[model samples]
Target: MIVQVALATGFVLILIGIYGALTQRNLLRMIVAFTVANSGVNLVIVAVGYLPGRTAPILDATVPAAEAAARIIDPVPQALVLTAIVIGLGVTALMLAFAYKLYEKRRSLDIARFSELKW
Candidate 1:
C-alpha cells in the first residue's frame, strides 16, 4: 500500500516535470524541471525494488544465511538509484553551467530569444 502511494507520487512528479520542461521558456526553469524528473525516476526505481515486509540485505546472527536471500530486499536497484542520483546531480550542475553561459552570451534567460545560433 505504501509502495503504491510512493509509485503514484513519483509518477505524478514525473508528469509535472515533463509538463514544466515542455512549457517553460527560461533555461533555468527547464533545467529545474529536468532535475525534478530525474528525482522522480530515482524514486520509482527505489520503490520498485522495495519489499513490504523485508529487511535490508545485511547479515546478522538473527537471520540465518539460508533465509537471507528470501528475507532481504534486493540491493541492486537501490545501488543503481544511488549511482543515478549522483550522475543526475552532475548533469544538473552541467546544465546550470550551460544556462549561465547562455545567459552571459545573450544577456537573457529566455530560450526563445537565442535563435541567432542556428545554422
Candidate 2:
C-alpha cells in the first residue's frame, strides 16, 4: 500500500520537475527542477527496491545464513541510489557554479539573455 503511494508520488514529482524545467527560463529555476527530478528518480529507485516486512541484507541470530536471501531486502538499488545521490549533488554544484559565473558576466539569470552560441 505504502510502496505504491511512494512510487506514485515519485512519478508525480518527476513530472512536475520536468514541466518546471521546460517552462522556466531562469537558470536557477532550471537547476532546481533538475534537482527535484533527480530526487524523484532516487525515490522511485528506492521504492522499487524496497521489500515490505523484510530486514536489511545482513545475517545475524534473527536470520540464519541459509534463509538470509529470503529474509533480506535487495541492496543493489540502495547502493545505486546512494551513488546517484552523490553524483547528482556534484552535478548540481557544478551547474550552480556555472550559473553563478553566467550571472556574474551578464547580471542576469534568464536563459534568453545568453545567446552567444545560438546560430
Candidate 3:
C-alpha cells in the first residue's frame, strides 16, 4: 500500500522534473529539475528494494545465517541508490559551478544567452 504510493510519487516527481528541465530556459532551473529527477530515481529505487516485515541484511543472534536469506531484504538496491546519490550530488555541484562560471562570463543564466553552447 505505502510502497505503491511511494512508487507513484517517485514517478510523478520524475515526470515533473523532466517537464521542468525541458521547458525551463534558465540554467539554474534546469539543474534543479535534474536534481529533482535524481531524487525521484533514488526514492523509486529505495521503495522497490523495501520489503514489509523484513529486517536489514545483517547477521545477528536474532537472525541466524541459516534464515538470513528469508529474513532480510536485499541490500543491493539500497547500496546502488546510495552510490547514485553521492554521484548525483557531485554532478549537481559541478553543474552549479559551471552555471556560475557561465553566469559570471555572460551576466545571464538564460540558456539562449550562450549561443556557443547550442552547437
lDDT for model 1 comes to: 0.91
Cα TM-score of candidate 3 = 0.88
Of the two candidates 1 and 2, the one with more favorable lDDT, higher being better, is 2
What is the per-residue lDDT of model 3 for residues 56-97, given as tens digits with 9 covering 90 to 100? 888999999999889999899999998999999899999999
What local lDDT does model 2 show for residue 90? 98
Instruction: Name the TM-score of candidate 2.
Output: 0.90
Model 3 misplaced stretches (Cα beyond 4 Å): 117-119
lDDT of each residue in 1-119, candidate 2, tens digit only = 87899999999999999999999999999999999999999999999998999988778899999998888988999999999999999999999999999989999999998998988
Residue 42 CA displacement from its true place in model 1, Å: 0.5
Residue-pair clashes per prediction, in order, are 0, 0, 0
Local lDDT at 90 for model 3 = 96
Query: Largest lDDT belongs to which candidate?
Result: 2
Tens digits of per-residue lDDT, candidate 1, 1-119, equal: 98999999999989999999999998988988998998899999999999999988788987778999889998999999989999998998898898888888989998889888866
Rank list by lDDT: 2, 3, 1
